[model samples]
Target: MSPARVGRVAVLAAALGALAGAGAGWWVDPGGDGTRPALPATAAAGRPSSFAGADASWRGASPGLDAAHAAPSDLAARRTGAPRGAVGTPELQALLRAPPSALRASLKTAMRHRDQGGWLYARALARQCVLLEMTTLHEGTAGLAPVDLNQPLAQRVSAWREQLAAGCAQLQPEELREAMNVPAAASGTSATPGTLDGADPLIQLMDRPAPPGSAAARERLAAILNRADPLMLSELGPALLQREGEAFVFDGRRLAGEDERRALEAATMLLPCALGLACDERDERVWGPCVMTGDCRHATREEAVLAATDADAGLDAGPAAPDRRAAVRAWVERLREAVLARDVDRFLRPPG
Candidate 1:
């Protein structure tokens, strides 16, 4: 194989490794003091693990729209399905009723005790509210066709966010710094860091103005493509690519222009996979819809997507098929090659 092909293969291997087990233990709690039980060694190694110790029954239950309409206190009391010592009805009520400053303090306290189920759930809910607000803001500003916010899922997300934000209009600015344990002096005089800038160095690189198609820019692009998590790359890739007339511009610079067809193809293929990974990983962003809709029956986002589009559609709750897995691997490799070569035309092209 050529050197370029070899590198692409290496990138695919790394991505697969990441998907398999590199960060699989996020849900694991070795101490097992009832906050969460430790997964078995096999489970931690990327095998299908039973949710025996966790109150995961909540995932399969559909609390329905009426549940959404119920008072927060009533829902909290009825949904005692969280693990022991998870946030209780009283605490939930307090959080819902707390003033903005008090809520911020409560959330900060929750951050400290995230190992406990109740605190973790509270933090997760708060994060989801922020994510929904961000999504709404992005949709409004991106100059793209906005999604129907009136859709059931969209409505649920909006309602959940509005309910949460009633007490806490926004998260405290220092939350991320405190969570990441960054020194106060390092962040300088800014009370709030730029969201993307603070989160990842790669994002900072993307935000900077670089000469179009320069060697340094290509190198930076290559590093981002190769090093990014598959989920991150899949989501961020399209945002970086903008269609300008017949050509596409990446990061606001006109690189080699690609037609719209290929860009759409790439998005169509990669986005669902990213969504699946997000839901499978139980990401906090998905928690809002899951909790609000109370239709967490789908274990994977792919399943959720299927059910949304076609109510009768069903997916096996087992591992993905070998061919589907192979397609994802090939897609990632293609993306890596496109980035390394600085060729937008090949970015989402399927491997020959």
Candidate 2:
């Protein structure tokens, strides 16, 4: 393999490792309890993992997932029984054109036009959003009508969505206060740190139940988006749209002033590319000879990318970088507007 190929394979391996278990225990205690269960210790490494592609024969879907394979938000194109083909590059291009700020709104608006049952995952997942304090809207303790399967499927899906939406919308402000440790007034604050300039398509195709034969959607999606403008596609996906409804707005509570805009520009500069960290894969997975020893901690792929980007820019690695916090705030607010209002142009900005 050429040096570039070798490096790509190594970063792919490191990223795969991070996705598998690096963040498993990295979660916050959502309940604010002294009582949440502790994350299990990292398991002992088992058989050494290799990059050899598996046989296509072992690639079949699990029982219920065997139905259609369109991405969860493809409302008009029900996956009912379509054999999963490669996700269209154009579809990904459209996605990459979306910036982090508009991610949730873009998704929610798309959901409005969706065919029934297209986002089945949301039914079970909706209430959990509140417990996690993901709601910007209210959900109340009200009775929802029981479902009747004999009802037309659209009726059933619409009713379910309405119930979920109302529940999210009906929560008292106090509930948000009780749920999130952060102040209820600051709704735009992010729970996840380091994601603003972290990975692109943070999840890989293999990271999720991607259609059996598609390339990693994030990489393909990032490429098509940045091809013209060189920076798009930074938010998480339709899953957030399904559950949060209007509450899923990224963050539009306040606009950045001139100073804040300058801070945002600094933050945006720190991004590995407007394209995302996914484009910068290289052998540099942290400092001081750790990848060979396997004893390093604090060296997940996100850490590696941050370190590599800093090194490439002749920056240092100690405290957080300039505008790190501000960047996240700006990014979230950007998503808020796109998700809430019906402005498609917000989703189409050229990378700065």
Q: Tell me model 1's lDDT, rounded to 2 decimals.
A: 0.35
Show where candidate 2 strays beyond 4 Å: 1-305, 318-322, 336-343, 349-352
lDDT tens digits by residue: candidate 2, 7-70: 4334333333333332222222223442221121211110001102212321232111122222
Clashing pairs in 1: 86-118, 87-118
RMSD of 1: 19.2
**How accurate locally is residue 307 in candidate 2, as Cα lDDT from 0 to 100?**
35
Q: Write the per-residue lDDT of candidate 1 for residues 276-321, one digit (tens) a residue.
A: 1223323322332333323334344333322222221122333433
- The CA lDDT of each predicted structure is 0.35, 0.27
On lDDT, the leading prediction is: 1
Give candidate 1 misplaced runs (Cα > 4 Å): 1-126, 129-173, 176-200, 210-217, 230-235, 240-281, 294-298, 304-333, 336-345, 348-352
